[model samples]
Target: MNLGYILVVDDEPEIRRLVQEILEDEHYKVAVADGAEPARALYQKQRPDLVLLDIWMPGTDGISLLKEWSSGGRPEVPVIMMSGHGTVETAVEATRLGAYDFIEKPLSMGKLLVTVERALAAERMRRENVRLKRAAEPDTFLIGKSALMQRLREDVERIALSESWVLIVGEPGTGRAGAARYVHYHSARSDRPLVEVSLGAVPPPNVAVKLFGAEQGEAITPGSFEQADDGTLVLNDVVELAAATQLQLLHAFQERRFMRVGGREPVPLDARIIAISDLSLPDAVAEGRFREDLYYRLNVVPLRLPPLRDHREDVPELLNLYVDWLVDNERLAYRRFTTGAVNALRHHPWPGNIRELKNVVQRLLILNRGDEITEAEVEQALGGRPRAVDSAPQTLFNLPLREARDLFEKAYLEHHLGRTGGNVAEVARLSEMERTHLYRKLKNLGINPKAVKEP
Candidate 1:
C-alpha cells in the first residue's frame, strides 16, 4: 500500500497547519483547505485519498459538509469527522452522512494514524474482493500457489478418484470443509448432491438414528448418509462424536446396510462418506473419546491440511489471486503491501490461519478506502505492535510504557511491510515516520524490505 494523500479541511489556521504538518511528517501528501468551500473545491480537483473534516468549520459545519460530500458520490473515499465541541447528535449525524469514523478533539497521534490506516486497509480488501469475484470460476480448484497448498491439491486429486472414506485433519480456518468440497466435487458421484451433516450437532440418543437408517416402516428423519445415496456424505467435526456414536458409525461402515429410524427394512448404503476434523482423531481415540475401530475405518485414506504459518510463502500469491479476481481487472488503485506491512504479516503467527488472513484483507479494503496501509495501521487493526528485527526484547504487553511501545512498534512494522508489498517509502509514510529515520532503523536492524517482495 502507498501513502495516502489527505485533505485536512478546517477553519482554524492552527488546526489546518497542524494536521498538514502531521500528515506530511508521516510522508503523506497533504492538500489543505481553510474552510469547507475550499475543501470541497480541492477535493473535487485533486481527489485525495481521505478527508479530515472539522465539525466546527466556518459556514457549513462538519455534519452538513459530510452530507454534501456523500451526496456528491465521492462517498467511496473515507471521511473521518473530527470535533472539539461535538455533541452525540453531531457525531451520529456525521456517521449517518457517510463518515468512516469519528475522531474527537485532542486526538492521540497514534489513534488518529491507526484510524486512517485501518480505513485504507478496509478499502483495499473491498476492492480485492470485487476483483476475485469477477475472475475465478465458481469451482476453481486449489487456486493458491503455496507448497503446502500444492500438497493439499495433490491429495484432493488422489482421494477424489477413490471410494475409500477419507479423514481430513487441520486447525480451525485451515480450509478443511473447502477441501472436502473439492474432493466431493471431483469424485465419481460429482453429479449427485453432497449431503453434509455436522457430527457435533448430533447428541448420543440421536446418533444411531442419524448415521444408519432405522427401517422403512420406522419413522426415520432420514440421515445425511441415506440422503446422499449414489453421492457423497460429509461428516464434519466428526471428532466431537462420543464413543457410543463412533461405534455405531463404525458398524454401519462395515455392514454397508442399516435400518432407518424404527423401520426394520434394511437398505444398502450407496453413499461415499468423507469425514473431516480439526483435531487429531487418533489422539482423541487414544484418549478414549473416539472409537478406535471407527478411527481406523475413516483413516483408510487420511489427509492432513497444511497450517497457514507453515506455508507463509504463499501469502502474497494467494493475496494477489484474490485481489485480481475481486476488483475487476485492476480498475482499483491496485495498491500492494509495503515492505514493512508484508514482513509484519509474514512474522505473524496466524493463529486463525488462512481464514484470518482473508478477513484481515477484507477489513483493510473497507476501512482504508483509497490509501495504502502502513505498519502503524496494521498494528492498530491487528492489536499487535510493530517491531524491528534487532529491537530489544519485550513481552506482548508490559507494565512499563517503553516495553509496550517496543512490542507495538515491531508488530506495526511487520504488518505494514507485509500488506503493502514491501515498498519502504509507502511504509514510512503510512507509519508517519521520517524516511531518514526509517531507513537508518531498517539498516541497523538488517531488515531487507525486498524479502517481502511479491512472488
Candidate 2:
C-alpha cells in the first residue's frame, strides 16, 4: 500500500475514527482531529503526505482552512475533501480551493486507500522536483551590479518586504524576467512554486488557456495560474497580449480570480501578480490598445530599468564580472580586455541590452584568446564600424541617449544580418549571441529578412 502518515480532519468524531482505523489497518500512520483548526495545527507541525478534509465543520470549515493553509505558505499538500451531502457546487468549490479531489461519503474503504496511495506518490514526485531544483540552483540571487542595477536591487529588497503587486517595464534585453525573479525570490512567497508565461512565446488563440488557465476542459489542459497558487506568476512580453487578453488579465487582477476557457465559475488566485512589458507602455495606452485601469493597477510599484546603452559606464564592470563567473563555474582561465577594447565596448551601441553583452563576453572567452582583448578584435568580432554612426551627419556626443542607442542597435543588427547573409547561426556565432537572444532582438527591431529582400 506504500503506507504513509495521513491527517483526517472532520468535525464528526465518528467519521474521523472510522477513517483513521481504515487507513491505520493499511499500515498507515493516521492523525485524527475533530475540527479544521486542530487539523491545521497538526498538519503544520509535521506535514502529512495526504489530508482527508470535511467541508462542514464548526468554526472553520475544510474549504476555508485549505485556503488559509495555502496562503500561509505550507506547500501544496494533496487534500481529498469528503462530504456526506456533496453537490456539484461544493465539489467544484473544494477543487478550486486547492483540493486534489473530492469524495462523497458513505466512504468506500478500498477506493479511499487507493486515492491516498496515488496522492502520496504524486506528492513525493513534487517534493523531489523541489529538492533537485534547490540542489542545482543554491545561489538563485539576482546577478548584476551597476548603478541602474543597484537601484533595481534596492527596489527588489524593498518590495520583497511588502506584498504589493509589481509591474516591471523594460526593453527586450533589459532583464524584465530576471527582475521579476528577484522580486519573487526576496518576497515572503519565495518558497512556493514560480509560474512563468511569455505573452509573445505562445499562440494568441491559446494564450488565455495557458495564462489565466483552462479547466479540465473537453479538450486542453489547465493553465499556469491554476498550478501556481500562493506563489509568484510572471507574465513576460505583456505587450503582445491583445485587447481581449488584456481584459482577461485586468479581470484576474481586479477579481483575484479568473474563469478559465470553457469554464463557468471563477477560480480564485492566491498567486502574486508580477507582469512585464517591453517598450514604453504610454504609447500603447495612447494608441487605445491597453486598458488605462489595468495599467494603473499593474503600475502600482513600477520598476523601470535603463537599457544597456544608457548604462554604458557599467560595461567594463559587467565584462569583469562575466570573466570571473566563467572562471569560477566553467573553469575557464580569467581573461582580461585591453583598455582599447573596453573603450570600444563603451562607444558601440548594445541593442540587445545585458544579454547581448553577456553572450559576447562568453564567446570571446571560449572562442578567442581570452587574455588581452583589443579594440580591433572587438570591431572584427561585432561588425558595423562605429565610424558609420560617427559619420551619419550626427555626432555621437550630440545625439540624445535613446536615439543614439536605437541607431546603434538597429545598425548593429542590420550589419550582423548582412554579414551572415540572413544566416542566424553564423550571425549568432560571429556576434556571440544566443539564438533565442538574437531572435528576440530581431523581433524587437521588427526586422524580417525576407521583407528586406523583397523590398
Candidate 3:
C-alpha cells in the first residue's frame, strides 16, 4: 500500500525521475511536475500529502508558485524547497511563505527521507489536534462511580468492539460528544481520524456538501465522510438535518457508497457512523422530523447517556475532576470546595447537565478569590438556591418576612435567568416586570447577567 501521496516538481527531467523513483521505492505514491503550471494542475486534481518544489523552475518560479498557494491562508500540505544554489535570504523567504523546510541539492536521500517522515508526522498531529478540539472535551473519560455510570461505561466499551453504526441519545450537554470520543479512542480504529460535523451549526443549503464533500472541476473539498474514512464520523445534532439530506444519507448508507456534491464517481463509505441527538430517533420519526429508514439503520447499537440529576451521587467526583482539570490545564488557582458547597451543588438541579456543571466550576474558580469555596459562593455562582435534601422546614421560612421575601425574589429571578440563558429582557417578560426594573433587581441580588449565560 502507498504510505502517502507526494508531488515532486523540478525543471530537470532527470531530477524529477530520480526523486520520484526514490520516493516510490520508499512505498510512496509519487506525482512529478516539470514546471509551475503542471504542478498547480496536479495539485488541484488530487491534493498530495506533501510537495517537493524546486526553486529555479522556468516560467513561474518556485517562490511565485509558493506565494500563489500560500495566498489563501496556510497551504494544506507541507512544501519543502530544493535548490542547488540556495541563499539564506531565499530560504527565509520560503519559510515566511510557509514552506516546511529548505534543503540544499544535490539532495541527501537520508535527510530527505527523514524530513519527509517528520513533515507527514507533523501534519497528522496538526489534524488530530483540530479534530479533538472540534469533536471532544478535554477529558474524554467518563468520570463517575454510580451504578448508572458504571453500566454506561460497560455499554460504551462493548459498543466500541463492534463495527455497527451507533446512535447516542441524551439531553443536551449530557456528555454525548464526549461519549462518542470515548468510543473512538477505545476502538480498533483509534489511529484513524475522528471527524465530527455539527449538523445544527451548518446551514441547510450546505449540509450535503459538508457531509459528502464537493468536487468543482479539479478543486476537491473532502467532507466529513471522506475525512473520517477507516475511522469514526460523528453526526452531531442529527435531528437538525433536513428531510432531503436525510433521504440522501439513507441512500448512501444503503448502497455503502456516496457521491460528492459535484462529482459522478462513487466513493465507498468506509467510516463508522456515530449519530448523536438530544431527542430520541423514534420520537423524531414519530413526529415526522426524522427519517424512519435512516433511524433503523443508525440505531443498530443505541447508547443512552443519563443526565447529571439522575446520577446525583457522582456530583462530588465530577466537581473534583473538573477542579483538578481546570487547575492543571487552565492554570486557574487551586481552590477546595467546602463540604457545604459540595452538598449544595449536589442538591441543585443541573438543567444544562455536565456542560453546565463544568462552566459553573470554572466560573466559581475565576470569580472567587478565597482558597475555599463556601455554600454561599456556590449558590451565587449557580444563580439559584440549592434545594434542601432533608425534610425539615426550609431556611426561607425561618427568616423575617422582608428578608424571606428578598431571598425568595433572588431565587425566583435567578431561576428564570438560568432558564432564559441569561437574557434579561426575556426574564423580564416572563416575570411580567419592566426590563429596567428587572435589571435593577438583578443587580440588587448580585446576579451577573453575563456570567449566568451558557458558554
Candidate 4:
C-alpha cells in the first residue's frame, strides 16, 4: 500500500535506511539515493511526490540539486531540506531557494513525519486552489444510488485494496475510465500518479517504445510503465493492442521486468495494471484476436460497468452531475430539471450510456434559456426519437403474419441488445424472459447479440 512516493536522499547509509523504513511504515513508496547523482536519476525516473534532501554531502550537495531543480522556473514537486550542522543563514538560503521547509537533523522522527504530512496536505490544497481559479471542472466521480450501481461501488472499493491487475469491461460510452480512476483514487497508491495509456491510439510501430520506453543516445526516455512506478497504469481499449505487443506485455508480466528499446538493462515492472475494453474478452480470446494468457493475467478482478439504461434510476443524479460540470468547466448557465423532465430522461434509452447522457444535458443547457427544463423541452431536444421497444421498422407490417412476427422479434431483440450493450442477462430481464429462453429466442430470430452496434 503506497500512500505516496517519497524520495529520501542522505549520504549516510544508516540514516537513509532508517528514514526509508520509517516512511515505508507510514505506507509511502520510499526511494533512497546515497547522493545527488543517484537522486537525479531517481527523480527523472519516478518523479516522487515529495523529496527529503540532506543539505550536506560529498560532491554535489542538496543545495546544488535544489538550484538545478529551481533554475527552470518553479519545480513541480515540493522539496524539504535537512541539515545536521545548520545555521540560520543556511536555513534562510534553503528557504529562498524554494525549499518548502528546512529541518535541522539528528532527526526527530515525530517532527519529520508531521512536517512531511503538512507539506503534502498543503501541496494538495494548492493544486485544488489552482484548478478552481482556472475554472477546471472536478474529475467525474462514480455517481449513482441504483442497486446495481451500489454493488458496483462496493466491488470497486474492495478491489482497490488489492494490488492485482483489473479488467473492466463495458460499452463504448460507459464510464470504464472513470471507474478505473475511482479505484486508483481509493487504492494504496492514491497519492501517486494514475497514468492512462490508450492502446488503440498508439501507433503499432511505436507501441513497444511507448510502453517499455526507448534509449535515445546517452539519455534514457522513460515510458508509461516507468513513469507509473509504484502507481497505477490504465490501459484503455486493451483489446486493440497488436498481437506482438500483447505477447510482449505477457512476457513482461511473467518476468516482472522489461528492457527499454535498445537498452540492455531490465527495469522492474512495479505499477498495478488496470485494463479496460468495451468488448467481450472471452469472445475475443475464442476468436484468436486476443491472447488467452494475457487476458487471464489482466482478468484477476473483472468488473462490468452497467450501461445507463440498466441503471435508469441514476439518470437524475447523472443529469445534475453533468450540469454542474458544464457550469464549472464550460461556464454554462445553471438550470434545474423539472420533475417531468427528470422522469422523461429517466425513461430515455441512453444508447451511448453516460457519455450520451452528458451530451444531452450539455445540449439542453446550451440551447435552452429557461431556468427549469420541462418535459416538452426534453422531447424537443431528443428530436422525438422513439424508445427502443417502440422503434420496430414499419416495413415489418408489409410481410405476412408469420414473417412479420419473426422480423419484429428480430428487430426487437436486436434493439434490446444494443440498448443493453450486448449484456444478454440485461436483455433477458428487460424483455421479461428467462436467461436460457432468451438465448434460444435470440438464436431462433437470428439475432446475434455480439453483432449489435453498441451506442
Candidate 5:
C-alpha cells in the first residue's frame, strides 16, 4: 500500500524532481508543484498528507504562502520548510507558522526519509485524535446476546467484507441506521468517513441540491456523494425520497458520477452507497409509489433487522446497556432495575423497538428517583399500555391451527373490548355477536372485562 500522498513545492526543477523520485521510491504518492500558486490549486483538489516547501521562491515566497495557510480554511496537513541558506530567525518564523519541521538544503537522504515518516505519523495521530473526539457513541453497535442477535452479527460481518451496495429493511425505531453504520465500521473502508443523509428530513425544494450539490458563480458546494468519496454514503429513509430526487439518485447509481446542480463536468463517485428504509420497497414499487428501477438498484444486498419483540430475550441486556449509557453520557443518577422489573420489560411488547427502549430507559433514569427500578415503575413508564402477552405475529404461525385461532380470537376480542371501553353491548354490536355469547367468549379467552375498562 502507498504510505501517503506528499506534495513537493519548490521553484527548482532539479530539487522537485529529486524529492519526487526519493519519496516515490519509498512507496509514497508524490505531487510536485513548481510554485505556491500551483500548490494551492493541487491542495484544493486533493488534500495531501504532507508538504515539503522551499522557503525561497521566485513569486509568493514560502513565508508568505505559509502565512496564507495559517489563516482559517487552510488544509490540515503537515508542512516541512526547506531552505539552502537557513537562518535561525526564518526557522523560528516557520515554526510559529505551523511548519512541522525545518530542514536545511543539501538534504541528507536518510534524514529526509526519517523526517517524512515522522511527519506523516504525527499527522495520522492528530487526525485519529480528532476523529475519536467526534466519533459516534460506542453504544451504536447492536446490544444483545440472543441467538438471533448473534446470527445477525455474523451476517453483518460476512456482508461487510463485500463491495456491493446494501439496502437495510426494518420497522421504525428498529436501529436500521445503526446496522448500516455497523457494516461501514467493519468494512475495509472503515478508516474513511461515513456520510449520512436523511431523505425524509430534507425539504423537497432543497433535496436535489443537498444530494447532488449546487454551484453558483465561483462558489461550489460539494454534496453528500462527493463528501463521502472513498468512504460510505448512508441514505436514510431512502424510500421517502421525492420522485425527482429519486430519479437523480438512480442516474447517479447507474453512471457512478453526478454533475453539480449548475456544473457541466461530472464528479466521480468512489463511495460505497448504503440505503436504509423502514418501509417495504417492493410493496412501494408494486403500488407505483416508488420507482421500480431505483428500488432494484438499492436492493442489491438486503439486510432485514428483526424487531425487538422478535428477540425479547435480549431485553435485559439492552435495558442495562441503555441505563448505563444514560448514566454515563447524560450524567443521570445510576439506577438498576429490579429482577421483577426486568422480567416485566422482557414480557412487554416493545412497539417502538430499540429506539423506544432507549428513550424509556433514559426517561426512567431521569424522572424516577429510586436507585432500583420496580415493575410498577416500568408499567407507569410504558403508560400502562405494554402488551402482557408479548406475542409476535410470526409466533402465531408456528402454533397449531386451533391454538392460533384461540390466540387471534383472544387478541381480537381484547382489542375491540378495549376500543369499546369494556361495554359488552357496544362490543357485541361491533363483533356482530350476541351480548351473552360475547360474555362467554370473553370468559373463555380469560380476558378480564374490568382490565379493559376506562377510568
Candidate 6:
C-alpha cells in the first residue's frame, strides 16, 4: 500500500537512487529525476504529493527551478530542499522560495523519513483547510419533512445516479446550492473534490480565467474546472454571467473540453457541472439575459426547488433543525419554540424562503433570553403581525365601526413603526401626521414605539 506519491530530484545518481529506495521502502511511490529539466517535466506530469529537490543540480539549479515553480504563487505540492554543500544562505533562499523544509545531504535516514512524513501531513492539513473554507455553509443537505421536500430529496437522489449535468432553479434562499451539494455527496464521484464558485460574485473581466484557468509560460493556475476535475463544480448564480462568458461556457460544454485563458491546448472537461440560478433559465433566455444554447446544455436534468411558502408544513421541522443546528454549531443559546410560535411561523409568508426562516430562528434564539420562544417573540423577530391578523381584513367587518376603526389604526401604525424601526418621527412623516398627534394616537392605541423597534 503506497502512502503517497513522491518525486526525488538530484543530479548525483547515488543520491537519487538512495532517496528513491528509502522512500519506496517506506511504502511511498517514488519517481526520480537526474536534472532540473527532467525534474520539471516529472513534477508537471506527476504532480507528486511531495518533492525532494537537490539544490546543486547541473543546469537551472534547484533554487532557480523552485523560483519557476513558485512564480505563479506557492506551489501546491510541498518541496523539501536537499543539499550536499549546506549553507545558511542557501537554506534561507530555498525556504523563501516556498520549499517545505531545508534538508542537508549526507541524509540521516531517520530524519529524512520523519521530515517526509511531516511534509505530507502538513500538505494534507493545508488542503483540508482550503476545502473547508471553500465548502463552508450552514447545512450541506436540506432540512424538511413536507411532501414537497420529500419529493425534492427523491429527485435529487435519482439525479445523483446519472452523470448528466444539473440545473437547479429556485427563488432566492430556496437552498438551490444545498440541493446541488446533496446531489454531489450522493454521486459516484463523492470522494473527489466538490468545488463551488459563484459566477455572480466574480467580476466579468476575470470570469474566463476563473473558470478555465490561466497559463502564462511556465506559470500555470488551475481554475475551478480543473480543481474539480473528477468531482463536481457548482456554479452559483450562473445566469449572472456575461454574454461572452455564456458563449464560452456553451462552447466548452459542446466540445467537452476547454483551453486555459492563454494556452492553446484543450483540457478535458471531466467534472460534473451543477448550475444554480434564482431565475428560471427559460425565462432568462426569453428575456435575452441568458443564452438559449447554454441553457439547453445545463438544463439537461432540471431540478426546481420549491419555495418555503409552498412547503409551509415543514416550517416547524425546519425551525427545530435550524435551532438545534445554530445551538450546536454556533454555540448559541438553545430555546424551544412553543406550539403557538410554531403555528404562527407555519402560517407566515416566507418571501425570503428558508434562508429568512433560519435567520429568524437565529435572531429569536439570540435576542430572547427566555427558555421557550413564544408567538409574540416570533412575531417580533419576523418584524410583522401574525398572518391571520394581517391577511384577514374580512374579520374586521364584524366589529362595530368605532372598534374596527381603532383596530385598523393600531395595525396600520404598528406596520409603519416596524418599517421605521420604531422611529415615531419617520412614521409620522410618512403618514403625514404631526409628531405630537401621532405620539398621542400611539399612546391611545397602546402601541409602544420602543417595543416595536427591531433588535
Indicate which candidate wins on lDDT: 3
Compute each candidate's TM-score over C-alphas: 0.52, 0.61, 0.71, 0.65, 0.71, 0.73
Error of 5 at 455 (Å): 13
CA-lDDT, candidates in order: 0.67, 0.70, 0.80, 0.78, 0.77, 0.78
List, residue by residue over 309-338, the lDDT tens digit for candidate 6. Answer: 677888887887788778888999988899
Please state every model's RMSD to the true fold in angstroms: 26.9, 12.8, 10.1, 10.2, 10.0, 11.7
Clashes within 3 Å, all models in order: 77, 1, 0, 0, 0, 0
Task: For model 4, give the 10-residue run with minimal summed lDDT.
Answer: 391-400
The predicted structure with the larger lDDT, 2 or 4, is: 4
Top candidate on TM-score is 6
Model 1's alpha-carbon lDDT is 0.67
For candidate 1, what is the TM-score?
A: 0.52
Model 2 RMSD, rounded to 1 decimal: 12.8
What are the clashing pairs of model 2?
Answer: 213-223
Model 6 lDDT at residue 94: 87
lDDT of 5 by residue, 1-455 (tens): 79888999999999899899998999999999999878866754655778999999987888887776665343256889999988999999888889999999998878999999999888667756655654545543367898888888888888899988999987555777778877887899887767899887787898888887766643456678866767899998786787888898889989988878996567777799999875446666766879999999988898988878789999988887787777787889998899988988887655456766776777788788867988888778766646523332323555434345555676677677677788788888988999877776675445667777442
- The 10-residue segment with the lowest total lDDT in model 1: 390-399
TM-score of 3: 0.71
lDDT: worst 10-residue window of model 2: 387-396
Tell me how far the alpha carbon of residue 204 in candidate 5 is from the true structure, in angstroms, after superposition: 3.7
Q: Which prediction has more favorable TM-score, 3 or 4? A: 3
lDDT of each residue in 146-260, candidate 4, tens digit only: 8888898789889999888899987655778778877887788776657789877788999898899876543466678876777799998787788988998999999998878
